[model samples]
Target: MFDFVRRHNRILQFILLLLIVPSFVVFGIQGYNKYSEGRNHVARVDGQDISQSDWDAAHRNQVERMRAQMPGVDVKMFDTPEIRQRVLEDLVRERVVFAAARDLHLSPTEERLDRLFKTDPQFAGLRNPDGSVRKELLAAQGMNSALFAQRLSQDLAMRQVLSAIGLSAFAPESVARAAVDAFYQRREIRVQRFDAREQLGRVQVGDADLQAYYDDPRNAARFQAPESVTMEYLVLDLPAVERGISVPEDDLRKYYGENASRYEQPQERRASHILVKAEAGGPADARARAKARAEALLAEVKKNPAGFADLARKNSDDPGSAAKGGDLDWFSRGAMVKSFEEAVFALKKGEISGVVESDFGYHVIQLTDVRGGERRGFESVRAEIEAEVRKSLAQKRFAETAEQFTNLVEQEDSLKPVAERLHLTLRRVEGFTRGFQPKEAKAEDAAVLASPKLAELVFQSETLAGKHNSQATEIGASQMVAVHVSAHQPARKQALADVREAVKAAVTQARAAQAARTEGEARLAQWKARAPDAASLPAAVTLSRARSQDLPKALVDAVLKAPAEKLPAWVGVDLGGDGYAVVMIEKVLPADVADTGPIDKVRQQYAAMWAGAESEAYLAALRKRYKVEITGKAKAAEEPAGAASK
Candidate 1:
């Protein structure tokens, strides 16, 4: 299972990205050996500490994000030395980018950062429709103002540095055109597939073979079960705390009086228009004709006010509102173009206006209805004001209380001390496995149990033996849990008697796969000898590298690279556990270059590659400019396989 981390590119790259990418860290002028490593500091950049808490939180989030993307992925697969090292490298690289950004004074500006807090997709999901960040939503995401602001500033600053580096990347026009021409060059080929699964009927396995295969150490992981624990935990719900606190009327009334305008709803009006065709630079009389037509429609609508919508449908040039019988829904002031806005706002409800000229054309305006803005009475919005005040007070109260909670849990043997002191319930979560299987795991237990860091601590030898309370794990901004293992289940291998049928099936599959590979190789050898123009086989189909087709990705990649030195070249792929597939390359084709290809497409691709190189080179330069020091256990994990942007 540890092989998953080695195979996952994200983990592999983070472990070795630093040495491979080569970047810098800025800090005070100090000799390397003079610096002492602090336990809290995971890695020191210049003189600043990248706190251990931050590192653990980042690793936890990365694992959770990966699990979200790939539901079948095992969490324990990421708990390897290689992955930890990679995560450190990612931090180091990020620091380097940030250092460079600081050197350029490219830190996120206040306005830009505010805009991001309100609109950047990651953080923006927590925003109200009006673009105000929701504190409750932010809390649910485990973010407070200070943490969010700091992270966002660093993220934006790094982007600023990278964008500046990428600015230097460009290609000559000729180079771009040639690259594009190569891209459009196409290839076509036919494949003859010999499926391994189809050949399974020819093979057989015995009981001896099954026992021998099961005994192999290489397959031990397949039979090993992960250690699990049934834990007892306690939670202090923040919302419940808020519910208990009652805000005085005087405070709510004071707040409302001080910010009365905030409670006011702005006036809104709805209008629909029938546009008459006109062109600013068309024939001389076109504008005049459009104005005359609008005037005629206006007089007719004023004569029969009820037929305004019918006239709009029959002759309105504005197709969007025409289909809806000229209903423009509603709009506040400054919502429409200046000329149209002024004309619509000037009219009374259900009033028809004279010809109103605007950018689109001359318009016959009709005012639908108007809503007058007003301030709500104190009674009308008391609940809203109270809820707001309570949330604000609760946040403050939580901050003050969290420190006490943290301190209490540190000195206690169990969560009982803290729960009893705070008048909170001691919650028990049972049968919690490291990897949360839906069938075995409880949905309500996910927030605490799904936390990788918390799970690691809960399952640690000390915690499992009931020596100490697991460290208080913060589930979100307002909630924390400290777990005590009530029951432990040590992982052990099943006896051969219990898994005989499973072992027999595995042995049969392995033997069948071997038989398929043997058959594929023999057939491939014979086909090479014959050297026929074409070989007809079962389940045969044609494919091309540059064309969209429905085939397994592994097969596509294998066939595309099959040596085409000779036409109808052959290749074989071992699908591992699925069997072998023999493929024949039927043709080698070139890109279409008769006419000049899409030069812009090739230029964009070249520009992207060029930008990445430029950015990497820029980081390497920063490494030379800044004084960097690796401390503590970080020395062993400095190498990282650098990742690239698309």
Candidate 2:
């Protein structure tokens, strides 16, 4: 958290813009409805509605993140009440932070935000090679400068509030030491098998027991199906539309002649530098020393220009380039820091600079190579021009035809007229649930089936009761899908007759597990009372905390944490669904911790963790102070009072 928060802090102070490394994922929310009045909202925070569209975007992003981490994760992993609740809780927490920032009257000036946009390396990916930020790029990234500043200011304000709240937070040295020891400590134990399978005959789970357990209303949800929708949507496939669009030979030739700069290459410059590293926020004396060292090196390079590479190899602080004699390779303008780029670009081929100052410190730079800009011939870029012209004509045709498609769909009784007019297919998908994500990463079919917002158009009160056409929904920039419900499958609980066998098996397994635990406890008690014997008590195997994979994880955890006043200590643990284990702790080995070095870093980490906890508590208090009404079925765990209690 500390590393991420302070990563881009050299010559920039806004940790909020850098993004707080929260305990859970915080998805980027788009289509923010500032005047979220009477909208379909999953949650209402501080009288501001978090619109359903924004929530869906955030939820999809969370799912994408999970999929990225666990490539082979089953669809059922996210088909739970817990994942939904967690996403809502994170959004609510963010809202709480924003509200707190507002109440505290915290806001930064526009000048500061604009300055950050220009200087921050975090936005480097969003910028062009010319060091300019375009409006088109901003919109493509789903962040306009105004909206970014608005959201970023609140985040910065939240950062201020958190820092203030956590000023007094600190973790004791003892606590840190104890935690380290507990983590590194190891123990070993040999297990005596008391298999639940062997004890299964003891559990006589009759039909009456199974029926009684299944009859309970509390178990009804375990047998219930999640809410799902089966939709019939008419798609205006973009690829299909583009294929139908024809490009004339004359248009392609004209396009190439007009947009000649698209095929032109920019001038490139390559330079190498021996760097003297110094942190911008560090002591001035250190910065001065680093600059002086860079100057001396610059003098030496100027005195013997032929031995520049040798000097860089021996003296450069940049590890990435030092081994290659400070070779940065080829780069264009705006590739380096403003000062370094300007100095390098200004120099002629083989020219060397005296010294240059940047956020990283001082640099003794030498220009190695320069390539002049040139434009490609029309013949060379003819194919590229043809493709662009084709797309341009296709988009223009799509824009004009989309409106007509929408009007026809709305006026006509059925989709046949629109399908006939557009020569497109009217497809129907059954059992379309939000949980139906695609196995393939690049598959496009799942997005259509899993869109809850569009599915709502078919499943809502009016649409479900009667057959009606939905509004033309834009699937992408060049495609629109209009959907209608053909059939409905309302969520219902599983009938007892259907789940009778399942209930019986569950009851039998549970009974067997309980019986095994009870019998193991009794046998362990008898063994502890008498002298240690091979037939009754097995000799303890030596194990350490680091390597305890041979034994059951539950048993290993019990042994490691088990208090030991004597040579052997025993503790019984019920390993859920796997019967019980009686772990005998034979030896306790703790980690050797010193007052300094790694221990000091551990102390700092603990303090930061404590501070984070304090900030969470403060945010919880703010949530209670505000009237936050969440419309969905998630618990109010983000509430100030509930959060504090937790």
Candidate 3:
């Protein structure tokens, strides 16, 4: 066989090529095309496509970040199409700014990056005393020092691009003054109000008017009942699971024993120290001098323990505590540097210690007080232990239970079967609408209904038409809900007989308001033709945007907007159901220039407005320059939670 194969090597190679090339052509090209189609580009920036998967990942990251920050908040509140669109826009903006930075050679220098990390308060937790990156802190955020530095540098460069436009904004004194003067300009006006309530007795509305009002197409929505459903749902949440879980007394005790330290309050020490100014890693001479100075303070404290505070106040280099007699107050383990903690813990109450060296400097320590370091007994924390154990068990069991719950809900036609199988409560709610919160709903039910996902599932065509169990929807972390809509009521206009009283009230109010407006207009005309005596009108009051003088906004607006160039101007304002007003503009007054504070504030506001506008314009220009295109069709705007169901 070996001899034969060696003889046919060339022919075998040709045969292998024929087979391999065909497979590559047949399968590999199709696989490549499928991969390309899977990308599903939704946006493009600087000719770089942003695929749907990328957008989803970015939005998921943002949602998770927000969830971590505010665990108690409902994730559904921010997980909307609008919020996702904003995230995509932000991603596009970031890409555009990054491209601009690269093109303009605006990369931040190493020195600037280091300076920012050390000086910026936001990064204080991520820096060591010597201004080095805290690798552990970065690791907690799922990034290494290198990655953090890269991100920080990029952010700084992008900020520089926007800051250039923002900082260049300036509002000249003249421009600022004109705007401020116009905004604050006051008008002295006398208003005569025709209260609708007073005119209600005079206005007449009968059955005919009520019927007409109810029959009007424009008023149909007012008499219509919103679409609603009566649903029975099964909630499989961590809390519900925990409620059913019962931890044995022995198990609780075992958990308590295993985690005894958690129930034990750590010992806290209150101490004062005279800190000498010198870095531990400073020159040998400086460190030595700091140690000597601390030793001298320690000796003085030993000689006169009562006068230690006075000496600390006078000589301590720690400015934070220098004025307060060098008091560091109460601190537990892991709160202070290792050397300082060790030194403080070693001391007896009211005992003074020799010089201790730490990252900041050397310190002469004195322990003034000690507290805590107590372990709670079994009976004292038994309830707490049981709750903890139950919650832990529920968390572990939730995934499996959730799977079963989902499967059972889908396999079965109703939620009752799943509820029974999972030993969960089958709760029922009547008149549950898509976005409406029942006035008498419990807190738990309200929170459940607040989930747009759950509402959407309940109103889905299949679920509504078939009256079957909806899919298990995740309303929150570790919270799944499956609802069965038992009864659905479509929206319909109420019969005129059913809504007669409401229609009658509406007609009466409309007639009264109109009557008031008519009288006000007639009075305004008469007052304009011949100026009424000052005694007949209400006392003149100054009005401005800043000060409404207890007048209705409509009246104030009408008074201020009337031909104020001519004094004693007359204007009529309809105040809706409240009534109407005839305002007499007595005089026009310029802004108070005497108050420099207001003028300065106006200038600052103007500058801020100008800067914001400039920044937005610049961003628009950048978008144009990058040829940014968003191809994703925006989802229809969703009604907010607790809004009208219709």
- Deviation (Å) of 644 in candidate 2: 32
lDDT of 3 by residue, 103-160 (tens): 8888789998889889977666456799897665445445577766666666567778
Worst 10 residues of 3 by lDDT: 19-28
Error of 3 at 329 (Å): 24
TM-score of each: 0.53, 0.51, 0.64
Q: Write the per-residue lDDT of candidate 2 for residues 247-272, one digit (tens) a residue.
A: 77787778887887787899888888
lDDT of each: 0.69, 0.70, 0.79
For residues 238-345, write the lDDT of model 1, one tens digit per residue. Answer: 775686589889999998999899888988999888889787676758888888888889889989888888999999998899977788889988889899898888
Clashes of each: 12, 7, 0
lDDT of 2: 0.70
Clash-forming residue pairs, model 2: 186-544, 186-545, 187-543, 187-544, 187-545, 188-543, 620-640
- Candidate topping lDDT: 3
